[model samples]
Target: MSDTELRNDGRLEDEHQLDADDRLRPEFVDAVLDAVENGDTEEAHRLVEPLHPADIADLFELTPDERRAPLAAAVADLLDGDVFAEMNDYVREQLIDALDARQVADIASELDTDDAVAIIEDMDAEDQREVLRAMEPDDRAAIEEALSYPEESAGRLMQRELIAVPEHWTIGDTIDYLRGHEELTTDFWEVFVVDPAHKPVGTCALSWILRTPRSISMADVMQREQTLIPVDMDQEEVALRFQKYALISAAVVDGSGRLVGMITVDDVVHIIQEEAGEDALLLSGAGEGDINEPVVDSYKARVRWLIANLFTALLASFIISMFETTIERMVALATLMPIVAGVGGNAGTQTLAVTVRALATNQLTQSNTARAIGREIRVALLNGVTVAVVIGVGVSIVFGNPMLGGVIAAAMMTNILVAGLAGVLVPVTLDRFNADPAVASSVFVTMTTDSIGFLAFLGLATASGLVG
Candidate 1:
């Protein structure tokens, strides 16, 4: 979030409109809606104009979907590029669809290249072209170049506006350059020291430049050990690099090593949040589970997974059908089987969650794959032994049959062991094939646990002569 200057006029001070979390209060939202609904444009403007752009964006999100357009129209003047930058993607799309190309272009021009591309990248080709035609030449060129890069790549995420100077410049010369240039980017943490070809040679922190004497050369002050991101590098890896190095900013370089743009921590903050949330949503097969997403979109993302699960469920049924005679001979077996399946399913899910998280975070690598599997196996065995002993003694007392108890105890242990194996192996195997392990692993793991639980219990019972 931008350090949005507070509109802290006395009106909102008395209203106490924002909660402790900095979210706008429901009552305040209702008041804005009431004013907008009443066609009290002046009052609506007074209530909303004092909010920072991010808060304005939140107001739009908290409003009902149908009412959002009206709110956007009501506060049209206050809806700037910063507000759009902070909006939920679906909500921004909804509002963007309402405005003309010229208005959209006007907002895009107010932002840096990265922010502008983010707003324009989601538009239809025709609309994007129309908006591009309306923008100033320099802004249009920067955004067009950014759009040429792969989506969610370092090239697309970096801003063109940055401070760069030659390595030979002294502190005085650099400070003079900064002072004389009215158009220089205002928000930079460091100055990039570049060669004659505009390739970054080092980074000079703002603090270092200020503290150094006038005669100090930039090359003398700068740190050559800097992180350089390739233009085509994926955003997740970019975030990881930022986290690992604790970088405030990094220079993005083209394939030939020319500095193309700069990526700040602010830009990566959103990417980090987005990728983290995306992996989680993908794990549940809930595509981009944004609250503002349309009902139809939500349905389309969720149904395919449910359908996949339905087929897997059918396979489990087929396995149970194979043991029809055994269940018929022992009614108690039918009653006890679901416990085994449910517990095993829970165990598989636990392991799947851990394995997926480790894979996503790069905590699990090829070198440690054997160790991870070994660790899960050890955990599974300990869980199986404890659960088995409890179920074994309980069943013997409850049914007054030692043999039936032993059969189920043995089956429970085996199923849990299988569940643990499936949980870790399914995701790891998918990752090995370069498939997204989170998207399909849970379905496979759940199916394995359920099918194996039923098969193990019934097969053991029949083999032990506890059933016909």
Candidate 2:
């Protein structure tokens, strides 16, 4: 029998068995393609059935867009909510567009509020409304309330399906209620104990409930101190709290401190990933760097930064222009000029990256801002002296113009010292004005270093009469 036939018949040798990475093997992909081409739906389904939802999502992502519809159709029911939820936003939006509103709603209803909202929010407004119309009234209302919150807030990240019981309920009652309510959330680490007005008072872990006596009241069994996330709180703050407290799950409350939803580790995992990615992109002046972002959208986001950089570049050019007479007199000044500027720019960038990250993580705040800036200035002074001596001696010998060499070396030391100060101070100043430091810091820092580098180098050369 052929290898494919043997494999299909469950008679493949151990040598033919696929390793973890081999599933995406060219031959395996070809085999699946061949099955699809030959209309062998069963073979296609069998080939992909063993993969995890995330793997399935990956498979969809790797497949050409043209082939995704056919592959999805062949797999049919295998494209469950889990697989859909795990898909890339681009792929998910495409798949959702192909599915009917009711079909999309049915899939969403099976997911947690956060996942469902994530999928629904990506759809067009009309489609989102239609999908909500198809959901059960309670599910629709919960999702609507979640949607009411600002994007990237705790309210939107929280799951409306949570386990909460009256404080008066005993441990046995809570357990029985949990077992009896088929409609309750399937995944939860803690049950909230609430007052009659639905205000959260305490939380009881599932383990505690299971271990406690049947007659123990939830109010007595539950821990009174619990971290509650406010609905309007930023998702980043929520992530910090989770990280700080080592929280598996935390209750999300509204203005009245009434439990509205719950934020779990699983949901927080996505938030953490997103926030980290956002910060990285912001630091580089790349806004929301999604691969699937439309060309026009990407251009709009990036062009502004490029233009700002152009203006900054011009500022550096103006400073260079002021030293035109010096450069015309000694061409060697032009050659050595870039060395000072390049080193200073690089040093500035390093300090900027560190300071931006510290600010984002709340490590550099008003309380320590002055101290941090002072420390950077000190470090910069030390680095400046070390770099100056090395470059001064090296250039003095190479050019045989000790005065020119000394001028360039002195400029390097001065510019680098200023670079470090500008790097940290620019970000802090922008942040104080309620601007994102990462997005604007690079532009400002580059401007400062370039302008200062040119001014220091050329100004010193002219003053010392080295290039007259």
Lowest lDDT 10-residue stretch of candidate 2: 1-10
Relative to the true structure, candidate 1 has a C-alpha RMSD (angstroms) of 3.3
TM-score of every model? 0.94, 0.91
- What lDDT score belongs to each candidate, Candidate 1 first? 0.90, 0.86
lDDT of 1 by residue, 1-468 (tens): 121122334133334444435347766677788889999977777778868788888999999988988888888999999999999888899899999999999999999999989999999999999999999999989999999999999999999999999999999999999999999999999999999999999999999988999899999989999999999999988988999899999999999999999999999999989888887898899988999899999999999999999999999899999999888998999999999999999999899999998888788999999999999999999999999989999999999999988988888899889989999999999999999998999899989999999998989988888865
Clash pairs, model 2 backbone: none
Runs off by more than 4 Å, candidate 2: 1-18, 25-34, 37-39
User: Residue 64 deviation, candidate 1, in Å?
Assistant: 1.5
Number of clashing pairs per prediction, in order: 0, 0
